[model samples]
Target: MQYVRLGKTGLNVSPVAFGGIPIQRGTAEDTKAIVDKMEELGMNYIDTARGYTVSEEYLGAALQGRRERFILATKSMVRDCSGMKKEVDVSLEKLRTDYIDLYQIHNIKTADFEQVFGEEGAYKALLEARHEGKIGHIGITAHSIDDLKTILSEHADQIETIMFPFNLVEIQGEAALKEAKAKDIGTIAMKPLAGGNLEDWRLALRFVALSGTCDISIPGMGDVEEVEKNASVCCDLSPLTEEERTEIERLRKELGNQFCRRCGYCAPCTVGIDIPTNFVFANYLRKYGLADWAKDRYASLKVNASDCIQCGVCEERCPYDLPIMDMLKKVEEDFAR
Candidate 1:
């Protein structure tokens, strides 16, 4: 199995890496067993996050004796210099590593650009961490294609990698991701399975691997079987077969209308709600069955789906013409239960 380089960071990682979101639902021992499988399979990249509850802590415990065997990565949502500085230290503490291979600004948005790259912003802290050898490279994760383009256009020089959702059904960021590849910025696919919306693991992973847009795809693995399954895809990044392309097209057409790609096109809710993020939480709650985790994230939203004014303004902006008002109602119903 040939490893792939993660953009200009120069870190060679397995094309199908371990995503740590599911670790929150498992025990430390479960994480350890999964890590053992990854090590045996030679899956050398592990991506976790500070926002994923105990994910970093669990992975840290799992990597106890063999931390050097994998290139570890984690991200935080902190925006300021002091907060980010503290977050980096906390990530190191939780990951059980003195150094992180890649540290990303998690789920960055357009409004976050100023504070993230400002004089006293998170970027400043990351730079200091890099200088101190606490972090190897800096990166950013975004849910919007426009935000991804903004990064490539203005902040490509400030970061080494970019993580965005890339799957057959969620290819809105495809062009920007290709631009990232051209700019020598590492591209990481965050939701290869469309947040559990895609049931065919092999097809989902293979599509990302052969897309030529993302350098690596991190499918959140909750168990040893998932780890092994995703690892198997790494051995074959060959072009998708004609039949596979047809299958992808079919799946897209089937799931397209109802699925929220989190493209951020439907923004500025009448009641100050974050439209795409609400869909994301609902996905985790309903699809992943992580009810508590999803509800907690949903609660963190300043505006709940129940508050949607249903003015239809967001729907007008959505390229997909998704029923944003009705979707918000479903989200509210799900959380209410």
Candidate 2:
């Protein structure tokens, strides 16, 4: 597989890395099989999170004696120093490792900036962990373009990497990602397949590889076949063929309006719903054939799509101007059936 330096951290990683979200649908053995394939293909970066249910634990088990074989990265949502300090240890324990390669402030929003970067904030915990040899570097993940832009422009000095949604349809982060690369902050592309909305895996992977906006693209992988397919593309960093470029424009027109990029601009749901999360669960049910898994996850949510009262507050905030109320209705219907 082809490898690249992860910005200021200077860690060399595969251009196509492993995303841990889909591991929630698989067993420990399944994770090991996938990891074994990754090792065989020389794909060395594995990203998981404390929020992805059993992802970190399963990966820890999968790594076993081979933890050194990969550059392990994971994230947490805790915002305060004390909580982040404890969560880092919990992540270490769950991953069965004394040290984590990279620990990220997970899914930061615009409103979270002050608190996260302030005194007694999670950033302090990460800095301490780095000093204490618990983590090698710090990164941040965001779903909003504006939030990522802010980090790239202002917080660039503090973070080594930034991950945001970048794919065939979600070019909204294009400029921000370019700025990130310019600032030497590693750019990671999440949801390369548009959260499974894009059916063409080869095209999706190729698009991100050729985009030049990201150092790596981590599409969620559950099994060995996926590992092989994603790994194959990394070897040849070729530009898109004429035919491929045409196909991309076609895809852009086809999916531009209806797809939810999960930017989270439409937040603060009037009824206290997690809008992007509801769409995510519904997408898993529709695309991953993980109906039972998706339903169980949706069940755990404090509020589901069914909770949306169609007040249209979320619609007003959406940059895409998605008919969120109508979309939530579909998600509710999908889960209800």
Candidate 3:
């Protein structure tokens, strides 16, 4: 496995980090098998979030006697000092470890830094926790460049790493990754497969590995074949052929502007609809061949696409300027049928 220095944290991590989201869908035995394979392949960085259900717990259980063999990172979404402190304690307990290699503020949006770093903010708790030996390093994650820049500028002293969605389709992260590198903050690229929208695994993995900014790209691996394939890509940093590059470009063009990257920028909707989540379910139905599953999941949402009130508020906030209301209407109609 190829190892890269993770910015100021000084941790040399493998190019292929283990993303914990997909493990939530697997049984404990399956998760253990995948993780054991990852470790065997020398992929040492494991990232999970408190919001990813039992992912951290399962990883903790899997790594019980082998904690020193890997770099474990987890995150919490708490914005207050007390809540942040409490969450970190719970995470430490769940992970069966006293010190986390990296602890992060999860899915930070535009207003998150100001909210978490301000007076009486969560950074106070994080700093205290760090000093108390609960976590070794601090990190922040976001889906937008704007939020990333804001965090870097405002809390550069406190942040040792940052995570963001980076894939062949969203090349916009390149600049942000460069900036983070310059600031000596480790950059972890999430959604390296475009949330499984990219059909060709080789092209997707090669694109991310060649990006030059990603110290580690964490693709959600759920099965043994996936682990082997990802490990193979990491072990051999081979570039894509001309024909493969052309095919990737064609696929990107076909996906077009309507593809929701799920940045969650169009949030706090006036009508209370979960815009990003609705789009996720729509994509699962259209691309992932989980139409029935997506429909059932969408129907369970308290505020679904069906609740969209035709307001253009979400569109105005979207950086991509997606016609969210129309899309939601289409989702409601398509899934209902």
Cα lDDT tens digits, model 3, 1-337, are 7788998999999888888888888887887898789888998999998888899888889888889999999999899998999999989988889989998998787766677988778888888999998888889888767877777677777899989878888777788788888888898888888777786777787888888877788988888889889888876676778997888788779786467766566888987888888888988898778989998899899889888887788887776557888888888888888
- List clashing residue pairs in candidate 2: none
Cα RMSD (Å) per model?
6.2, 5.1, 4.0
TM-score winner between 1 and 2, please give it. Answer: 2
Stretch of 10 with least lDDT, candidate 3: 256-265
Candidate 3 displacement at residue 184 in angstroms? 1.8
TM-score, model 2 to reference? 0.84
User: What is the TM-score of each predicted model, taking all chains together?
Assistant: 0.82, 0.84, 0.84
Give me candidate 3's TM-score against the actual structure.
Answer: 0.84
> What lDDT does model 3 reach?
0.84
Off by over 4 Å in 2: 261-308, 311-322, 329-337
lDDT of the candidates, in the order given = 0.89, 0.90, 0.84
The residue-by-residue lDDT of candidate 2 on 41-135, one tens digit each, is 99999999988889999999989898998999999989999999999999999999999999999988778888899999999999999999999
Candidate 2, after superposition: displacement of residue 134 in Å? 0.2
Scored against the true structure, residue 268 in model 3 reaches a CA lDDT of 88
